[model samples]
Target chain A: MNAFLNQLPIGLSIGAVLLLVALGLTFTFGQMGVVNMAHGEFLMAGAYTAYMLQSWAGRQAVLVALPVAFFVAGLMGLVLERTLIRRFYGRPLDTLLLTWGVSLILQQVARDLFGAPNVQVKAPTWLVGGAEWSGIRMPYARMFILALAVVCVVAIWFYLARTKQGRRMQAVMQNRELAACSGIATSRVDQRTFFIGSGLAGVAGVGLTLIGPVGPALGTYYIVDAFLVVVAGGLGQLRGAVLAAFVLGLLNSYVEYWSDASLAKVVVFAVIIGFLQIRPQGLFVLRSRKLT
Target chain B: MRRLREAADAVASAAVRWRGPVVFVAVALLLLVAAPAALSPFRLELLAKYLCFAIAALGIGLAWGKGGMLTLGQGVFFGLGGYAMAMHLKLAEAGPGQLPDFMVWSGVETLPAVWEPFRQPWFALLMVVVLPGVTAFLLGLLVFGRRVRGAYFAILTQALAAAFVIWLVGQQGLTGGTNGLTNFTSFFGLDLADENDQRVLYSVVAVVLGLLYLAFRQVVASRFGRLLVAVRDGEDRVRFLGYDPALVKTVAFTLSAISAGIAGALFVPVVGIISPALLGVVPSLEFVFAVAVGGRYTLAGAVLGAVLLNYGKTTFSEHYANGWLYLQGTLFIAVMAYAPKGVIGVAGQVRDFVAARRGRAAPAVVPPARVEEGAAA
Candidate 1:
């Protein structure tokens, strides 16, 4: 019973990390319909950003790294969009292959720059401790990640719901032709979407440093899971991503607890494949009138 | 003189008709006779390994290029076939009623039930083709039945590959763990250590690849091939026209999986190992890379691409290990960006350009606009 209670926070924290990594994918893959395989690299870029900042900022580098990493990753995404991805627009599978190439390049670059070993970032002093309540031990780092996820979600909600540019992005996602007809500059919206999407991955990376190992292959480990989250959550639906991420996270946590880690991975994949069998469109379906 | 001219015209038209088969026979002769005679024992074995990859590439060509299913997890099928063959080899090496060496090391008291059936060489060989075929058919039925495709299908397949590798790694007692099944002494009754036996093995692989290539070429030229293209270009339209797109896709996917399995099975003997490392997401993507580089739409191109790209990989890695990933990544991006149809497509363009320059009408070549237009719509 105590073990189960302990697992709740751990599960939520895992879900938080999943949500963070998947948030950017929601924009690029879901909204823009571009399968950016290099989005994981953006997370890597962010983690590396935090690692780099440690020279001057010490343990507190993570807090300052968030906004910086977002921009850095965002800019990298913009360059990828303008240079290579733009040419392959409307072709999701090609983009998948193209971005995979970009991912390979980025991974090699990371390996070359950082060497083949994992570089550890010192957790902020505040994030080192944990709060214990009724046999549930919730580390401050996990709590911080959860808090960050919530804050990012709220900010994103506000941006999409309240801001005009956010609505423009939504309009483009819903119907590109219709949005273009209304002078939305669908290309600009796509750029913005890619930036935010990639930026969110960077933020996710920042949070990940507190919980997981930071290395060149770090992105590859989470890329599939993040993708699965977006896949099960459905495209162009924020609420769906949230629901799916948490569910998958809890499933992952509990399953890993019950069985071994490797088996847990297989089980999660099986569940997703089985789930996808029933709901091909996923947990949420976007209602569109466009015909192909 | 008029009769002689008429006869010459008749011969020219016949040559055009027989071009494909003639070329196939020529390539077969080159692979079977010329390759083994020219290359060293080590190089011949490497060529055999590449041919295994080529067989898998042929399937990718059919499914991805023709049927429009980007199967990113072909390694799963490949691994399935390889492991089946590896199991049988291990069993044979263990001799009658003995557990494989790894099983003993991992404290497995008896041969596991799954390993039991594999002891029979025929069953193992049969499973090399059957397992992947069945797995693909079921997966295709489930995914395609619900109309889940495109990027979703690719991602799902990749995830399956990842899961498969993880499962393989975890089963230490049964699967030989991460080291995988290696150190085979014999195949069938032939000694693996002997050079003559190795050459014989190479001959068998080359022959199999040639036959499979010819078979798949026939498949791609038939009415079903046209239907597959139609389905790829427009699935909804094909469905409205009273053909089940799902069934057609499933068949193509199944065939591809079977070929990948066969490739994997052959890969074990040629390469002497079947590890989780070779059956992961990256390796599966590498299979796709070969297809993309060669020109996915052409059967011959796929084979050529597999051999050439793998050759490039071997040579490049041998000289500069650190730079190979960069080169590979660049090759993918460059091919996708400037040469969407790959090397064959580029060659076609060059031929057309030369014909046009020589003041002759360029041959009627189908534009590779189906994928772009379909996606755009």
Candidate 2:
């Protein structure tokens, strides 16, 4: 029980990070139908952006680093979308290749600027330690991330359900032709979608710094996981993505307890393959006439 | 009168086609054939490794370029075949009834059940081809059977490649655990290190690649090729025409898997190594990059893409290992964003432009040779 308790923080922390990344991917896929393989690279960019800010402003302002990372990475994402991704809107494969190239470029840039070795981020003093709850000790950093993720997910859900722009985005996702016909600017939706997705990736990058060392290949590792989460959930379905992330999170955490991490990945993949075989449209695929 | 005109047009096109592409292939062949003599033994070996990569890229071209199945997981098939061949080579070196050095080092008293079949070279070779084909066959039957196309298929394949790498890395006792099957020697009693023997190995691989290319050319020119394109372009329409999209895709995917497996089998002997580094998700994506940059829909393009990009990687990394990835990434972006049809497609456009300026009728762009006959434009 104690051993299990000790491991929960790491698992949940990673899960929170995964959720943020997947949510970004979910938004993009939902709105633009682009896989954005470079989504993880965006996270890496954000992490680096945060690190750079910390160096300039010092570690005392790590909280301020959060919004700064979001702005920098989001701007990069906007540039990527307007310049490269927008041209290949309906062409999923081309977008995948192009973004992958972007990812490689971003990683190499980091390697050049930060060197090939891991760059460490000093955690804020307030969120450095852990507190015991129900005989289980969870780190404050992790709790901060978990709380942030919950708040983000809920906030996005409310915005999507209630706000005018959010509804327009949802409308565009549901039926682009119909949305356009009804005076919704699908192009604006695309821009907003890119911003939200990239912003979420930046947030996730900040969350990641709480636990792991920020490195060049950090995006390579998480991008695949995000893809798995998006696919295993339904493409473009936020709720589905959240659910899938949690399920995968719990499954991986428990599996890591008994097996080597590598083996756990294999088992998870096998399970996903099997699950996909059973539910090819994914666990929470939305029912729409346009799905075909 | 129409028949005479058609015959003249065909003859004229064929003659024009032979001028540029034939010259290119001839020059490429001369370069490849003369490379061992001109270059040092080490460079000769590195070039051999690139050819092995070309073999894998050929499959990607056929599957992605022609068949329209974005098989991002060719690495899994490549790794399966590589590990199989590596196992046999390892067993042969270990001699009768002895476990491979890594297994013994890892404290396995006896050979694992999975590694047992590899002791027989014939069985190992067969499995190298069969295993990947069967896996792809089953997977395609399931995924395509459910009509999972586009990004869904791509993600699934990538996940499988990642899973394969993880599995190989984790199985320390069985697989040598991430260090992968290395330090191999003595292929079927020949000295692998001998300069002459290495040359012979390269030539043999060259011949095999040539024959495989011809075989692929023949396969793509058949009726089946048309069906694959039909399915890729419009699956519903293909179904309306009485062709089963699932079956067509499965066959193409299986053939591609076998091709990748054969490449892996050759890679082990020619490259003298098979590690997770070569068959991981990164390598898989890199292979896809080669195909895309080379022009996935063209046969010569696939082969050329694989060879050129790999050479570029070696040269770039040798010079700038730390920052060269940016160049590679930039190349990918440029190729896709600027030339979706790839190098061959660009060449075709240039040819058309020259012909147009010369006040002659521009030759029709030759469809990629890897597509089945009816699918050819």
RMSD per candidate (Å) reads: 2.0, 4.0
Q: What is the lDDT of residue B365 in candidate 2?
A: 62
TM-score (chain B) for candidate 1 is 0.94
In order, what lDDT does every prediction score? 0.91, 0.82
Tens digits of lDDT, candidate 1, B102-156: 8988899988999999989899999999999999999999988878888888888
Off by over 4 Å in 1: B1-12, B352-365, B369-377
- Summing lDDT over every window of 10 consecutive residues in candidate 1 chain B, give the lowest-scoring window: B368-377
> What's model 1's lDDT at B92?
88
Best by TM-score: 1
Q: What are the chain A TM-scores of the candidates, in order? A: 0.97, 0.94
